[model samples]
Target: MRWERGRRSRNLEDRRAQGAGRRTGRLRLPLPAGRGGKLSLTSLLIMVGLYFLIGPEALQGLGGLGGGGLPGGAQVGLPGGGSGDVASGPLRTTPAEDELVEFVSFVLDDAQQTWARLLPGYREAKLVLYRDTTRSACGVGQAQMGPFYCPGDEKVYVDLSFYGELRSRFGAPGDFAQAYVLAHELGHHVQHLTGTEARVRRAQRSSPGDANELSVAMELQADCLAGVWGHAAAQRGILERGDVEEGLRAAGAIGDDRIQGMAGRAVQPESFTHGSSAQRQQWLGRGLDSGDPAACDSL
Candidate 1:
């Protein structure tokens, strides 16, 4: 949470002023047939989140919301230009939004630095700050999808407005909570670099019935990876009192069971793609307690 004195990342791509240049139609998610010949309520919401809340390529077995290859090391367009091109124009942003940008830049740099020390041959991933919608190698990224990391392009896309929703709607307000979001996405990038994501994708492909379970495991591991960064940050005196709690709250707030309950549906563990609130908190806490990436391998 002590980010004002931190170094800003050079890998940041700011395209807030460029605009999406196209209207995003209402997204309709297809509920594939599940157990018992019909998808459960939990399965339905998982499909909704798959198509709109996470990265477009988060689950490649599903239909293409956008075109891309495998989840790990997928060849795609480079940063700066493409469907999400940045046009030359004045950037309009309020003081609060500008501060948020600075904060994220600091987190991105700090987290990558930690990984560079912890993992061999670690590569830095770019973070794209956009408004409304932006083009990623996986697909068209909209604000509604929250924050996601596209392994195809090795870039993390974020819409700052989501922070407001994280606070007001999800009740997970704090700078560290925002940092956790970016850290988790970057964790996915780490998985991509290490071939963990590729292996998981292959497993999902081989076992179509267990795809959701595999997704839950992958997501929980990412949460733990985020906590690993949090542990490093704390040791460096970057975190203050209550920062860890903010992150845990954020993790719990977006848990599959909690989100299902919020939607007035019964909590179902079988359809969970991101684990339950307890599972998320437990994995994140494990990393925080151990400060070791190996501790996260239990997933």
Candidate 2:
């Protein structure tokens, strides 16, 4: 994406180096101490059975990993070692990081501007970049949970290292991919501002069995919003020839099915909080093709 000359948002918050505090210490997991300590076939079968029964959450606990004892930690699936061991801190980003930040800020400005012009009483949302954990209106925010928007605070939180995963592991490399991620989170902010997020969350509680489906709709709508931003960027001459493809790739890379597959499992549609790869691509394409926010009603 041609983003350098674009407008940067003032809502970008850099808290990369603020570790909250140093980790207690190196966490040493227990391993069986014996000759030929390979797990028994019976044990393996039982573990597999548990995996099939309880899902990825069981797998993480069985492995004795996770930062904050949750899945998708630095040890489990993160690109960089999640420690943010920068001499100057993760907030003291490099020129390349700065470029990415600037690009995201510009896209955020574009998306918020679009919303402001299109939606009544639209308020700009703050996007925060932090390392490890940070306090938010939605309790402690972890980088492992990836980027998220807190509806209560009307803020978006991200850890830039995730952009590395978006590139290396997810195979969605490019500046535009990063922008798409930012725009998606901000799209959640849009949902919050429009009261869509709260209504969905409330409905999720009442309809517990279909909670995941509601979340999928919410996520897909965000993808559509991101696509809308992509279209706007194109009209503004900020998008390059392959930029839309980059965003589409990103939308696919983070699909619930692809993520579940990477974590070693079958694609369980009912369990998906985010939509499937095809659904995400479809929504993104819908917005890209139409460039209309009104067309993003996945509900």
Candidate 3:
């Protein structure tokens, strides 16, 4: 993505070291005593299903697995594990982590610069870089949840570990794919600033049955907004050949349908919180092609 050509963000805060507190303890889920006390797969699935009902944050913490990810934001506490209070310190980074830091800083700063001129009185949101798990105003922020923006704190949270999963599991390897994820979270910050997020929450309350559908629309709009940032980057020559393809690939790869299929589950449209793969790719292309924020009116 040629991120080195971009400016570094002054709003970047390192919380990686702070998030490295000791694990709370091992989870002891109840299992029916069997021959030799072996736990059955049915018992495992049942326990996991119980946690899932609690919330995404609780499910991930309880199972010690990270599967589903919302497009932009998260709410609720991390069910168990990790220290609640994270001590502040400078981030201790290795050579690879250092590269990631640089890339994130550049992408964030450039996105801020683009929004500033596009939206009058635009304020940059701080991007918090943490590891393992940490506290956020919205709820618990964990590496497994991927990148998310907390409107309550006006900050974007990310863990470097997510970049590995983006390449390995999502099959969207590239600096552009990583940037696309960050840009999408920042897009949520934009929605909050524009009062769109508040209005949507209110509407969701009034029409609870449409909650998932509204969420899908919100996520699709974020994807479009991310494409706007990509457009600006391209005009600045920061984007190289195939960068758009990488971003598009990421958009499709993380769609609700695709993620559900990846888990070997039924792709239920009514249960979709994020749009389908085609919808995501189409919206992203709309923003990139038009290079206008108005083109992202998914509502």
| Leading candidate by lDDT | 1
lDDT for each residue of candidate 3 in 1-299, tens digit (9 for 90 to 100)? 87674344689888777744422212235676557777687887877775654345442211111126532223222322234443444444556667778899988888989999898989899999876566677666666566778887898888677676678677889999889888888788888889888888889889989977887788888888989988988998989999999989988888888878876788899987768888989988887888899999998
- Total colliding residue pairs, candidate 2: 0
RMSD of each: 10.5, 8.5, 7.9
lDDT of 2 by residue, 11-90 (tens): 88877667622222222223434368787666667656644443443222110001112124533323323343433344
Q: Is candidate 1 or candidate 2 better by lDDT?
A: 1
After superposing candidate 2, which stretches have Cα over 4 Å from the reference?
Answer: 5-8, 20-72, 75-91
**Least accurate stretch of 10 residues (summed lDDT) in model 2?**
59-68
Question: Among these predicted structures, which one has the highest TM-score?
Answer: 3
Cα lDDT of all candidates, in order?
0.75, 0.70, 0.74
TM-score of 3: 0.79
